[model samples]
Target: MVTHYGRAVLHATRHGFRVERPLQNPQALLRVAVGIVLGTVVGYVLDQQMLCVGAWLAGLGSMIPHQRHRLGVSAASAVLLCVVGPVVGVYVHDVTWLLYVLAFLGVFAGGMLMMFGIGLGMRAIIMTILMVALADLAPDVPTGLTVVKWLALGGALGWICQLLPPHGPRFATQRKAVAALYDALAADVRAAAEGGTAPQPWPGPLLAARQTLTVLPQFSRAAAASLFGLVGEAERIARNVRVLQTAEGAVPEIYRAQAAAVAGALSDVASAVRSGRPNAVTADWSSGALSRTRSGEAHENRVRDLVDALTEAGRLVDVPDAGKAADSWQHTELTLLHSQPGFVARGLRRLREELTWSSPVLQHALRLAVAATIAEAVGRATGDWGGLGEPGHAFWLFLTAAIVLFPTFEHTFSRGISRSTGAIVGGLIGWALTLLPDARALHYLVLIALLFLYLAFRSTGQPLMIMWITAWVSYLGAGGSSAWTRTADTVIGSAIAMALYLLWPTWQSKSLPRLLASWVRVEGQRLGALAAAWADPSTADPIALDRMGHEARAARHKFDEAATHAESEPVHHLARWTGPELRLLSRSVHEVAKCSAMLTAHLPGPRLPGVPDAARYAEPLHLVMSELATAAETGAQPDPGLTSGLRDIFGAELADTLPAWQPGPDVFGRVTHSVEELASAMHGQEAPEHRIRSARREAH
Candidate 1:
């Protein structure tokens, strides 16, 4: 019932856990339980040397949904872990404890050396070694064959857990996350207009939001790995949609107005909540720019129109546009994110505290990059041998770590670090469990119970807790033995990863404000292109626009990376000044989309949407943007009248009224503010257009 953030706060307060995530639906949880039980029994039978694993772990072959079947992947890793685990375990088992320790060091060094290696090989190799050493600790000597059989069964069961169904309370969580951002931006525009009061804060929710970002990439990765095929479409849909920012061409003026309103409203909400004020600006239903006012009559038509354009822009994909009030209601995602700046915010907070690019999403990426390189190294060392007989199938783990992880490098670091931290804690717990005066079966149960506990409730970005729990289970099945070796291996692997990633580093990163400055440059260049285009609408300069798009993409990517690095590297992540800056970026780009639409739209021979030269408003808008960028970079308030003055001048001179055009929510609010803010930014600056006036003066 509680929103994700609320639950996070509750968990943090109650369990000393700040990061929290969704509760699996009863049905989904039940399915996992079923899989585990069946798997345990099957594994039991197989350990007794009974069954054939003519593996289908590749596709839906292992009972995981076809969507999730990495049959090709699992087949390879399972083969290695199963076949190689014992061979390596056998030879190493006979060594003295000192020799064993030496071997561990060799594996550790090998992991880093193979850092540039591919895939899940890293995990396969190291884990294989751990399994082998673990077998040696058993009272009875484990033939390589026994280790292989048990590992195969365990792996098959793990695969089955991943194939479970998605039966959660489907509140469209993913969709909500994205939509909230849209709504928040729209709200900001409206708030800026009408000389609105600042919004009140919402502390409770902010805590939850903070926890979400704190959870790392590993959890998401683990979920996808487990869920496989079913997860692919939904996740890809979100990702591709996000990348559509620069690709958007245009939209209707009314829709633009509405989006502007939402942007303003969201900004207000974010500011208010972060400041801890619950009495945020109340929504004014009548303030919108839709064709009609009533919900039933106008909401559907107007909302649908906006949704359609969003699709055209590649921002929104796969919406039915029924315009349910629930669908359009704001505060779902963006506010949640803004409210709990702690999780996502800490990175930015640190960045800003230290002049790094401090945006939430970007910070996460940086985290991922740092952590992944380490995890990759760890996985590689698991099965590797510097010069021993038959190294572990660690190459599989390496390939998996490299290939499956890190969409954005920064994010991977964030995720990998979170995983390592959690893994250490969980691994310790697993060790503690071994010390209990319990029988072999009891030890296995204790480990499983702890694994389930973590799976059910931990707030996480990294699911290393899950991995540790599994490793502990392996130890137990090996018969209350090998805890010391397993623990050592984990700690060593984590250390290797951290050491390599931290050592003399990529960015030597001193100043992140440069990123903000660079962001302005990128935004400026983009505006300049728009300016040239607006200067003459009839001129088809596709190349400039194309160039602008590429620049925007690169800037966006860099900003994200900068934010990530800023969050992770130094004591304080750099680039704090960048957060509020999103306003200008979002606003300018939205205008660019509008300008593109105005110039490109062919209307039976005319652009009669409003006044005569409304399309020509581009020149002034461009001027406003150039000045705004300068002011934003300098941190001083610009003349607050230029953009507004331009907007008004354009409206009065060019806008003829649209018949029956009821301005959507807060149009007056939006138009009034965007111009005001633009003007404020441009105030006192020598407008780029000033050259035109000067040239005329010389002629006079």
Candidate 2:
């Protein structure tokens, strides 16, 4: 019979074996391969194998996916490895006991630094641990210093290679991301015009574009601002298309041709943005379509406004002097200026906030620290027993534990399985390769080939990548005995990591309620902003609206990520909502976001009549959502009448002013229905409508 712990391990193991398709990036492959090759060649020429190893590891560390900061990360990684690794190596050679203490502190510090960001934190841990491992491998102080010189040489070469490829203009990645968003929007518009089922809300590209643009250097502020404006226009167009789709029969059959033309134009805009070319908006379909429709009709007005938006977007894309246009846009400049706090100050503030015991970063750091220390002690003890060949072999044990123990149970568990399996397989491969080559030239060729394959298939999944890494390291160390020893160390280290997680698991369920609550609060803010825009379009700040949209999208992404991880968990005692309840609530929140987007899409122009009581009606809805958020957070029941009161007020307010053809009443109704469902779910009951629908199905 399986024990409770056994069953939990089995469950997590199943999730661990899942694999993702590999991504192919030729530029990245070229950059990493060239750096490694150059480092290895220099090390061989100098007759220092460990120096080549340092170069290989440093090059690997610099292989971050973000092009914008890849150069900076590469340079930093080189410096950290060359300087810190040598210093640690030379000192630890004399004071053997000092190794364990530094191991614990380095791992803990690296984990804690993750509170700032993943990139910074991971680099710190990798550099620190690798340096200690390298120092352990050194036979003497003189050898250690020589290795440091090699490291510096290798690192410098890697940094210089990154500068070799000018991928394109400064904001190329940002442009590509924004262009992809437009492509998605165009596809959505075409689908909506065909009366197909409304596309599911996919905010990924939009969020990516926003994030990429936000990180651009201040020197390209003007160009970045233009890209930001394009991102905003893409969002607005998507929202309008969603609004048109939701209003059943809003786009009459006669106007479908015009809608198709508009979609084609959007495609052209995407192409223009991607290629950095001007797109002359030559389409007259909007004017011709307007001429055929009656003036002031709801559908006609929507088409006209959409056309005007398309025209403006085309003009923005074609602007010859983007900097001049960006200068004239005072609001975007002000937003950028306001956000320019010193980097050090911003980092410190974030660090302070994450220093608490409740922070996930701190919790993960503690777990990693404790685990690494334990691995180091156990490795040394095993070495004393002669179970491992040497004390230096403990580096494998320490390295495995450091990399495998991640923040969440799912990742840590999965990585442990992958790392173990790959290490075992890779060790066998390395041992087999040793049987074929007694010659030094043959050995170097095999090593270089293995390195190239490793970098190329790095994206395939951890198991494959780790296998290649293990093989290369085994080959570098030179012998079947060493390979076997490394494999054994890896398996033991993986077991330790798994045991630590089982004993002190950071279950995603524990954070689900907080994430869900945060999402609800963000949606409430987005609705309030939409209401304000509708009340007075002239006063609406596009930058503020864009910011709110970005926040809502980010919050939704967080909740979704937590929900996904929580599903694989063996226990849900800490979760406030059941799996089905979480799914229903997530869907309801998504609907609420879509409705808000639709309302924003139909916001009147400056000269048009405004919704007189838009804010007054929205106030109650916002308060109700806030209360629901609070209830989710506190695990308390919300007011039973909160959603009902929202519906009553919203319905009454929109009934007098909004036309029958308008989506305002429909959007409000959908929002209220979703809110009511959330309230019912919180109270541990099926929503009234959900129950009624179930009964109808049963009767049928």
Candidate 3:
């Protein structure tokens, strides 16, 4: 009968229990589990009463798996705070006014420090809050130290457990992503060689490269070097494959066959990466048709160059230490004396700069300080003048305000909604659990499960974190069926946060234009440098070219971030309407960047004598870029003469040598064409309806 009942429930909820989630990171779970168990065991061995306290205190560091150095810092941080918190709490318990003042100042300082960066600000404020809360819980300074030691021991044990894993679960994901990217590259090459269009590598695999870079260092220095090296080789191979596609029609059939062989070589390289073995990539150049191709010598030479580039890329990949850096990868670990670099200096500089009161961070800080202060005060007033007593403890109200308020108004609003909803749901669950038999044991188990889930879902989304945090808090506080008090406090706090933002909103749309302008300007300058170098290699400075590239990429990143923020605004009509324009702008800028990269790659090479350099034509190209930048910034029209002049120069200088140069000569024409389209797009001109229709037809 029991089995039938269970089967019925399982059958009914089968679909409901299904969820789509990314593969879990087992290392994260292991870290948390090890820390909790270690801390609990140590505490229990020392004193049974210390078991829960030890896990609670040490569990903070175990919640997230960071780099080795960061883990150390986190452990030290947990230890220091655990020791200091209880003592501070005791003192604050005696002086209610001091507690209020410290709470205000702690949050205010945290806000001010946050201007430097979120990491710095978050750590400072969170640590301070922990200290104050711990102080209240501790009976005296001596007992606080004991709790601190146990907590530190647990945190330290968790940190030490990180050393046991040879490579983390994230590292495996990184390796797989890199392998997938190479596989995609190989497939594209094979497609192009088979007389088909080479499909672009999907952006998903490319974006995953960034994730690989982030986690590679945490695994091992050797792995980091190998991965980075392989990535560099993969990039070269990809570029060469793209060049082959561009020159497909002109190249002989034999070269296409060779491309197929090269694609196989790339596949081998990818296989080697997956299998943890470095193997030599072999490509057969034995095809006698290479020497007998009817295609002109220029076409033959270009094909040979492509083949050689691919061969060299394969050879480089086979080198075991090609990507290894000599320098140590370990950053400075958290210590009592040597803190994170720029923490003090940058913090002070930012604070000093924001003193004029115009800084958004300062304004936000002021808002947060004011809102949190009021919340704390109200909580104290409601809880027998300090909110320290039972039943009416108002700490949850202050916590709600602290968590809800964010740097941007949109963030605050969104978090306020999600947090309040999650809190209500979680609180109810906690209340329900309290009514069950063996509730005490169940609470401990639930808390442990929540801790694991929180870490696992940290990178996934915010909803789960909100739910778990609310449940965790309620289970610790409310021992009854009614968690209504905390729920009400959360709602009230969220309302206060929303009201403060409404009163003093910081709309991202207001600043997006400036960011866009900056992006355009930097991109224009980068293109100018590339064009100048192509015109005359003598003018090229590798350092300057690299700096411009970095700056341009940074500008684009900033533009994207600002645009994201702007789009999140409640009233962003301007941002919404400019989406298409921004997309066009981004595409044009990327094309320019690609042109620069191609030119940069070809810089130290064969020069044709008697041919005019890009120097004569560079001025008009630069002017076009400058005009585009101006148009992006001030809505000015780009002069058509710039594009026309470059065209005329291209005809006069390179028109006669077109056959000899073949694809290389076409670079100038492509650049000029791109400039024309960019200028037209900037002036609010979409592609002709005929062209759009043609593209759609082709796509279909």
Model 1 scores what on Cα lDDT? 0.38
Q: Which tens-of-lDDT digit does each residue in 1-700 have in candidate 3?
A: 4563344334323322233352265655665566666654554456432444445445454443332254555565566445455446655665767877787887888788765445446655665666555544555657666665665555556556555554433244445666777787778777766755445532235445533454333335344544554554565455555555555255457667656666776677677665555555565443443334454534455456555555554554444453244133121110101122333454466578887765677787888877877776676566543333344346666767877888765567666766677778877876776666654445556656655555555544445566666666666554642365666678888888877877877666666556667766776677667756655555466646655754665666666666656544554454423656656655555555555545444443335332346556566566666676766667566675556776666655755644354455555555565666666666555434325645886896
Give a tens-digit lDDT track for model 1, residues 614-656.
3455455556656655665665566645455654653454333
Please say which candidate is ahead in lDDT: 2 or 3. 2
Candidate 2 residue lDDT tens string, 1-700: 2464466567667666666566466676787678777877776677656555666766766764443656776777778867775677677866767877777788888898765456666777776676667666778888777777777877787777778774544466677887788777777667766655335344867767766665565666665666767776676566656655665444476456656766787888787777676554556545654345444446556666567667667766667777777766544423643245544666678778888988887888888988877876777667633643545777777878888998777778788987899899999998888788487767777888888878876877777888888898788778777788788888898888878987987788888878878988988887877777676678887767767777888888878778877876667656777778777776666667777777767667677767767767657667788998999888888988777777775666665776444644766666666778778877767687767866996796
| Model 3 residue 463 CA deviation in Å | 2.5
Candidate order by TM-score, decreasing, is: 2, 3, 1
Off by over 4 Å in 1: 1-17, 22-33, 48-150, 153-289, 293-432, 435-444, 457-481, 488-496, 499-502, 507-518, 532-554, 564-606, 609-700
Better of 1 and 3 by lDDT: 3
Worst window of 10 by summed lDDT in candidate 3: 329-338
- The TM-scores of all predictions, comma-separated, are 0.46, 0.87, 0.72
Local distance difference test values of all predictions, in order? 0.38, 0.72, 0.57
Estimate candidate 1's RMSD in Å.
15.0
List residue ranges in candidate 2 displaced over 4 A. 1-15, 19-23, 67-69, 92-105, 112-117, 176-180, 183-201, 251-322, 330-342, 384-390, 532-546, 659-661, 684-686, 690-700
**Model 3 TM-score, all chains together:** 0.72
